[model samples]
Target: MESSDLRNAGLKVTLPRIKILEMLENSDARHLSAEDIYRRLIEMNEDVGLATVYRVLTQFEAAGLVRRHNFEGGHAVFELERGPHHDHMVCLDSGKVIEFVSEEIEEIQQRIAAKHGYDVEEHSLVLYVRPKNRVAGKVGKG
Candidate 1:
């Protein structure tokens, strides 16, 4: 079924491509760079190379099966574009990422775009932040 989806999207149905697509679709870590995907493949004992991961991800992005995000980091991260739209919040301290959606924020963006005499084609909002209040023994960002 996944291979058919890939074929429909103009991609060759291959083992590495199918495995990478599965990882992107099913991972708890929705946003991942090519390096991250490569690490995951290695962890799974798959022989897919890092260069293959990068190439497959780029192909997926071009085919609109995935979306690439360039957060504050120099590297780019890719996410499967198969769900509702949402923005991201990144914790600077721990490199944690959170996804959120706000109707009010969306309205504000639309209004701003209208005011500027341009239809909003797309928008990406990433808020880089840290904890407001620190709790003892709390070292993780949520």
Candidate 2:
């Protein structure tokens, strides 16, 4: 992903966009909300406004460079488009996200769509889970 790609998509390559993209690129988390991104940016001393982060994220979503997810209540989160399609499992207690690929689930989805005579364009699946008492370092699969 390059900044010029945004320009090609008719979006101006602004500092906030660049910084947000960079942070997203370097992030290990699979899901990040606008507030989370803003906090990270502030920690880096970028000082970009939260609204700016949200606007840039919306632009990125419109450009198809990022995907927005609503796994945790009304707050929206984003993830970069990378590899094959997958779903998410969010830990309710820790707010950790886990990515998992399930062929069985995929087949079931396809069958359901076919049964309804509808070609699936796009879809998102998010499972909310609670971890057993383990106090693990991180609570998610890649």
Candidate 3:
């Protein structure tokens, strides 16, 4: 998102907002915590505060510019709201978040919802998983 996108979202186009939005738009990691953003900003010598990071993230969530996921036993993470429908697999050991889409699962969910006489308006699926062949005392991220 750019300055114009922020203005379109009814948010003022400020330096902090622009920097944060650029981080979200360009980061390789799809999901990130406020602290993560704050650390990166600090690394880049930006003077944005942690509180400001939190506030901006909250505003972004409220404005539908991002989505927050509160995975079990972890701090909330935010992702840009610009992707296709997909489910998440959170690695239990490494806290990695993997996104996937399966037509088979979607069809089965539709069939089950239809059998129950309810249309599937929306749904979210998160599967907490660990590596099947995990090496002892090792962790991996995806």
Candidate 4:
């Protein structure tokens, strides 16, 4: 992928880099684990190794091309960094990850920081939740 985004990130455009970037951007699943990416590559008949996927994803994270989430599990999931910031809601039952943004939450964070006489530079909030009915436990995001 000969992308200006790649060049600006100070990364050389290679097949692996291009394919990985494309996969992240085009995939319907907003977040993906490295194994998910590797499996997709194999399904597409792309000759990308799992190790190479890890390496490329790490490089992208370093370059600010993607953001990694260490949600409850030790495994990390990655999403392309398209500029807006949002928090996550993880479904404890199904292990689903949902992305959401709330103006109220954002304001509350800033207010809390100011009350402490400290400016907010950055923060991450993850809400671990299960279905209200628990019986259904089908995680979903609106």
Candidate 5:
């Protein structure tokens, strides 16, 4: 999404927004919550409030700069929606997120939508899976 889009949405380009965007840009983890983002901002010595973080996230989502995903839980996660679309695989044990793209899945989705005569605007696919073995990898951001 364009930075100008934020301006057009009547949101001032504040330091917190810029910093939050930077963190999201550099992060390998595709999804993060407002609390997750606020914690990171604190680690970076940014004096941004959690409420402000939530506001900025909502603004970004409105501007189509970020997408929100809920992986079978109460807390929602945010991810920068750039490039092509993809689905997620979340490890139930560790909450690790993996991004995977599949043309077959896309085709299937399109076919289903067409069969119902519905146009898909936006969609989310999250697979919550636990490791077959108890030996799961480290917990934290992916």
Candidate 6:
């Protein structure tokens, strides 16, 4: 988001906020933690601090500009909320996050919720996974 977008979100257009927003929008990796953003900012010679990163991220989340996922066994990661609905698959071994959408899964979820007499308002699905050929209980790279 640009400075105007930040203004539109009701957040003041400050340097840290602008830097963090630009970083989030331009990064190759869609998901990032506060530490991740801080490290990258350091690498880019930007003066944004970790605390500022966290604060900006929190503000962005509150303003509906980003989404945070607290995956199992990991610090929270943030991704920009500018996409169609999709589910996530978090790798148990590599900690990689993959996004996918399945109509069948959606339909089943809708059917189940309907049968229970409740309409699905919102939902988040995250499947923890390992490599398909990996044996059970495998720890890490061989």
Ranking by TM-score: 6, 4, 3, 1, 2, 5
Task: Name the candidate, 2 or 3, with the larger lDDT value.
Answer: 3
The predictions' CA RMSDs to the true structure, in order, are: 4.9, 6.5, 4.9, 5.5, 6.2, 3.2
TM-score of model 1 (CA atoms): 0.89
Candidate 3, which segments miss by more than 4 Å at Cα? Answer: 135-142
Model 2 C-alpha lDDT per residue in residues 55-137, reported as the tens digit of each score: 99998999888998877564788999786999989888778888999999999999999999998887889899887876767
**Residue range with the least summed lDDT across 10 consecutive positions in model 5:** 1-10
Query: Model 5 segments beyond 4 Å from truth?
Result: 1-5, 8-10, 135-142
Worst 10 residues of 2 by lDDT: 130-139
lDDT of each: 0.90, 0.87, 0.93, 0.91, 0.85, 0.92
**What's each prediction's TM-score?**
0.89, 0.84, 0.90, 0.91, 0.82, 0.92
Error of 3 at 8 (Å): 1.2
Q: What is the lDDT of residue 129 in candidate 4?
A: 95
What would the per-residue lDDT of candidate 4 be over residues 1-142, giving only the tens digit for each residue?
Answer: 2388999999999999899899998999989999999999999999999999999999999999899999986499999987888999999888988889999999999999999998989999999998887667457898
Q: Model 6 off-target regions past 4 Å?
A: 136-142
Best candidate (score: TM-score):
6
- Number of the top candidate by lDDT? 3
Q: How does candidate 5 score on lDDT?
A: 0.85
Where is model 2 more than 4 Å wrong at Cα?
Answer: 132-142
- Candidate 1 lDDT over 1-142, as tens digits, reads 3888899999889999999999998788988989999999999999999999999999999998999998886489999987689999998778778999999999999999999998998889999988988565757877
Q: TM-score of the candidate numbered 4?
A: 0.91
**Candidate 4 off by > 4 Å:** 136-142
Q: What is the alpha-carbon lDDT for the whole of candidate 1?
A: 0.90
